[model samples]
Target: MSDGPQRFAGHQSSHVDSDAAIRLTDTDAVTARYSAVQKGYIRDPFTRPLLPRGAQFQPSRPPLINVGTYVRSEGIDSLVTQWLELSQQEGKKCQIVSLGAGSDSRFWRIATGPHRNTVSAYIELDFSENTTKKAMAINKSRELKGTLGDPSNVKIVGGGTTLYSPVYHLIPADLRIPPHESLSQAFQLIDSAEGPILSPNLPTLILFECVLAYMSPAASDGVIKWFVDYFATSPEGTVLGGIVYEMFGLNDSFGKVMLNNLKARNVDLPGVEPYPTVASLPNRFLQLGFERAYAMTLRDIRRSCIGEVELERRANVNF
Candidate 1:
């Protein structure tokens, strides 16, 4: 919990278990976790693409702007692409799981006609309270359908709904704990009547975007290991999909600048680790029995866009 730079002075008062403590569950809490200066940098129109629109609170600059957004966006795109590809190959129901999916509108963004049919289910995992808030927001937005007109096709069902329709399942589980146990229990309870149940061969696409950076390196390693181990429970040829991670430079100029600013404010984040290089990530995957897979950097994506903004991409592997 005490991994990175303390962005706000008042944040220290809330213990990790405190209700006021900032966690990934609430969008505001997640946004406030970033340094004020970083928040500013993300708001800049030119750099806005790096950060998701939902996370941006106001227009301001932070010491670490470009690196943050670039990594986040690239990770999101990577996972989405992997999910779509896996669905095509398996020719079975596709299950898309978003870990710490904070205000990401990917389900709506990519949910087109044929594409929607490919995905049998879309699950967004976050804190129970946060997920409830998101569902409420979606429902309220519907009342103004005349104006917004159901922004996303996400249907808010009281319980689990049909697989063909877009359903948002808010599984309130904590990432810091063992996710598999909780997930197994959830599947048992939710997938009782849903024939075949949740299996590895069901084309599961798990995504962790902008979530790993907040955790310590050991924690991140553990999380990845858990996923690999969980997938082993599935039948052979059961692909675990891709694990997309977006990380910022640890020793980059921007990082140093942010550290100095935090130091001046009398707040220290001792456990913060810099982004891991691409070459190193493949080995991590190999340790978990995952093959060294495809990867791309934010720099390459920006280059393809032919924009003036220069972004840095680290070697990322898809496993």
Candidate 2:
């Protein structure tokens, strides 16, 4: 419903290896507001403000392919902000950790916006190479850096993390490792940032944006199961939520061609075969110890946010 399966209908590597693709994608995202890019996201007020002052970049695809990217970013921002506000209204402490959050500016946008007080802590996890680049991007920009309280009090540690921000933290940790070991280290960073030990029992939300699809099903399963087990038994009644945005329908007609293209690059999508459809994903999550799981499709994004009227208007935009 987000109005552009037509947008995605038209859709890699730099210095950091496989992860470089993510960074470059984000690089394009920051400058997407430039009039020359012709993206619908040029209208995304949140995105433009989050970018550093002079982010110039080249287009990597025909503009149509990026329509879906911007729409999805807008939709996800709405989703996360809605939840954060709900948690705040309920008087619950909240933590949101975005997996593979490459140069995404959700935290800074939310922190400085009207709902700035909604979340207690926000953490971003990515490879060190990407996180360091993001940190520098934030620090160099007076606008980006201003959102994190007093500028002089801010600090980055281990080359990729902010060790002293009360609300914003950038953590560089490998998600492919055992979840307990990797996530515990991430939580400790949060503990330090927030000035308290993170209880196993805390209201937390984990966001995986197409990150799980790159992993083997076994690895993804283990991570989800690990989280379920860790928070399910908390005496304080910690409620947990996971918001996953995954790529599915691979091995099918349109997807098969795309999958093969990625495979040629030696990118193995181990999770594709195991959970190949959005419908299949919730069942997979339930089986992995998630008591309840929900999924939103592209159509849902269109219908739920942008209405049919706007969709038809965009349909007429010649690309």
Candidate 3:
């Protein structure tokens, strides 16, 4: 069965409030604001390059026993760490592609820092609306820095213009469908000037954080298949960096308790049949033609920030 874009539209608004939910038409603007809010809360100074002034502000969490922080910090940090390590690998320049990259600053932050020269390309793929917003943000940053005599190293790639420095190529393609075909068109536009995909000597790392769970199982499977197909065919070997923070089925008393809580909140997630243990993620990766390079649970971070939580899994995939 074929699913159009709206297959997931209803699910999107249910995940967050209207103010925080990413609109298909203005996803880029929403992403920028979301990133600004995150940076302000995490106190990450690097976010200054992407977020506009006065964009930083704190949101009040639900009083008493809010477990959302664990959902954000550990899951997000693990994904960032994986991407950073891939970027800093020795001898070869790596290409980092962020899938559904909502307001992520790793490219800008890492590119401008010690690993700037080590990265061959930093591509951020998202909805066209969001990608355009990011480009505008990057251009605005360049303008602001020019006034201060300190220019940024990021460059927007699509729309037929290419600059010399580390190009922040924005391939605005929808991932919910066949990304390879759409992405191929975008890359052709980019490859016309930027040369070719970065060499295979340095691995390409793709990051997917907090995105799959929101997708239907079929769409999620399509996404995984797209990545596996890309890496299998691409000249470069690709490593997938993924953070899965949503609830899966419970196998034990602990798992049941977690599910009950989510059920109480009227959230029903698909994908886990009879709900496999979170540790079963490695098996899922292997099923999708990816070998698990590393896996860790952010239970500690969850405990510290959001009280006791049953499961959060982070893994790195190599093909």
Cα-based lDDT for every prediction: 0.51, 0.68, 0.51
For model 1 the local lDDT of residue 19 reads: 26
Per-residue accuracy of model 1 over 76-120 as CA lDDT, tens digit each: 565576568667776766777777765555665455334666766
Ranking by TM-score: 2, 1, 3
Q: What TM-score, to 2 decimals, does candidate 1 have?
A: 0.64
* TM-score preference between candidates 1 and 2, better one: 2
- List candidate 1 segments past 4 Å from native: 1-75, 143-166, 186-191, 195-198, 259-276, 304-319
Error of 3 at 251 (Å): 11
On a 0 to 100 scale, what is the lDDT of residue 91 in model 2?
Answer: 81
Report the alpha-carbon TM-score of model 3 versus the true structure: 0.62
Best by TM-score: 2
Per-residue lDDT of model 2, residues 1-319, tens digit only: 0011112333422223554444454455456534223544334333544454465444444555556654576578778877887887888778887877776767876777777876777887777766776787777777777778887677877744444576777877677788777777666754354344344556888888767877778878877887788777789878788888878877668888877776676566677787767779899888987788888887789789777776666544545
Model 2 clash tally, residue pairs: 7
Candidate with top lDDT is: 2
Better of 1 and 2 by lDDT: 2
Q: Supply the global lDDT for candidate 2.
A: 0.68
What ordering of candidates by lDDT runs from best to worst? 2, 3, 1
